[model samples]
Target: MTIQTVAKQLTRTTKYRLNNGHHIPVAGFGVYLLPPAETFDLVYEALLQGYRHIDSAVIYGNQKEAAQAIAQFVKDHENVSREDIWFTTKIWNVDHGYDETKKAVEKIALEVKESIEYVDLILVHSPLTNKEKRLGTWKALSEFNHNPNNGVLQVRSIGVSNYGKKHIEEILAIDGPVVVPAINQLELHPWLPRTELREYLTKKGIVIEAYSPLTQGRHLNDPELLELEHKYKIPKAEILLKWSYLQGFVVLAKTSKKERIKLNFEVLPEGQGTNDPLQEGSNLGKIDLDPNILDALDKPDSHLVFTWGGADPTEYED
Candidate 1:
């Protein structure tokens, strides 16, 4: 499809149907480096601003705060319920073996049971372990996904993170009928698009969740991004987010500021509400970049790649 076609199709509230038949919001709020003391209030504010998806992980150290925030938001809202929120958490690298993974997941389910019903999705945080342990971890997650009555861990879908072609192929090559991963959360931005892997995942029907889609605001001052910001009068991060959504990837935006959380989720700046007269005849009239600009932002040269957190586990040998 053409860039314009993709742009026209994308909206602030688009949802992608996962391979497991569950739908995930295209825009998600992530709390990666958020301070433990401030996670609750920020996450609650994100829910109040219409973010239905909350992405957290064991490594992030704020999963409990996030769960409580979701639970509280549902209780305080009129029609919202546990089902209205999509809560996702990941198993850390330390918990990569079959037994270890099971224990970690069970611990998560146990810890958050009082707050939320069940985790919407659980992903192996990274493919940092050897093949044996990686496949073993996937096996455990697959079991939990297939057997709902497996005690407390009622995960709707299971997936992987930071997995590359070889890592995914290892799971696909299993001898028996293995449950294919529903999603692959990855570090994606204009600079590191992983073109080949993205096409591979698309063909396999695995949804790609764009984690760090904004480059963690590290390179928001790129000349090209600045150009778009000036031309569109929107924040550089929004432009990067639009580029990510336009590519049919689920976007996870992390922010601690209440206003930026809303802006990131809204994809529509404060004064540019949908009812604004300027957006009358436009499709998703929030912040539509020209096709040429989108083309330029489609993954830059190798030297320009910006891997947030100073590490790219997808390329890990293990």
Candidate 2:
């Protein structure tokens, strides 16, 4: 289909304002593989196509280009300021801790190019076994939040990744309220639903961000998903992204191609059953799939495992 047709069907803003009072576009575009040079135009096109939120990372190795693209977009469009953009990046595992988290933000801000000092959200890439160190890192994030003088070094919202209920409770149960983690980035898909985790976070008023909703193409070959893909007349990838949408999570999907990105953004109306979710054995409440099915997917025969980073997703028993 034509770009015009795709744009026409683009439904509600995939972006969502998080519980922390910060906003994120519902469907943020990403550039995980493009070199810095190529990323500039890809990001520019994504923003021009109505993607306000951009997802990048230091490890992804293209923040320089991504930032350049955002800068050029603002320069070309006089009315679009840096505030018009929602940017997200993660702190690498090596940088978790109070001081490192702060410096990480400082580093990302430098790459963002535009005059804006800080990105919208910065998360601890994943759970760290080093308990005391992780606490220090969170402490650093809190310092960033409470500091008014740290412009550009200041991050609007701070949170964790691949975290579980235990991890959050550990922090929150501490003396006085701490920085509430705004979103928990996790792997989510119809085949591997996070029902308990979602329910727990919902109670805490935290948003769940889904990363590998398409299971990095692992689910594409599933008998159930394939059947629904054919029935909906939508590509399987779109079906995967949409399934995450139906679960009420902010989904980040990546594509350098305008066509693929557009298709990823086309969401079906809620309750439309576009993926035929009603198929037997698809329900999370029933399926007994191993939680570590991801490792199996990464087996030699399976495709590459697509992952950004973990904040925290708790399968905490309700």
**Candidate 1 collision pairs:** none
Q: After the best TM-score superposition of candidate 2, give how far the Cα of residue 132 lies from its true spot, in angstroms.
A: 1.3
lDDT of each residue in 120-155, candidate 2, tens digit only? 777776675466667877888777777746775667
Residue 135 CA displacement from its true place in model 2, Å: 1.3
TM-score of each: 0.90, 0.78
How well does candidate 2 match the true structure in TM-score terms?
Answer: 0.78
Each candidate: what lDDT? 0.80, 0.64
- Tell me the spans in candidate 2 whose CA falls farther than 4 Å from its real position: 1-10, 113-115, 268-318
Runs in model 1 lying further than 4 Å from the true structure: 268-287, 303-311
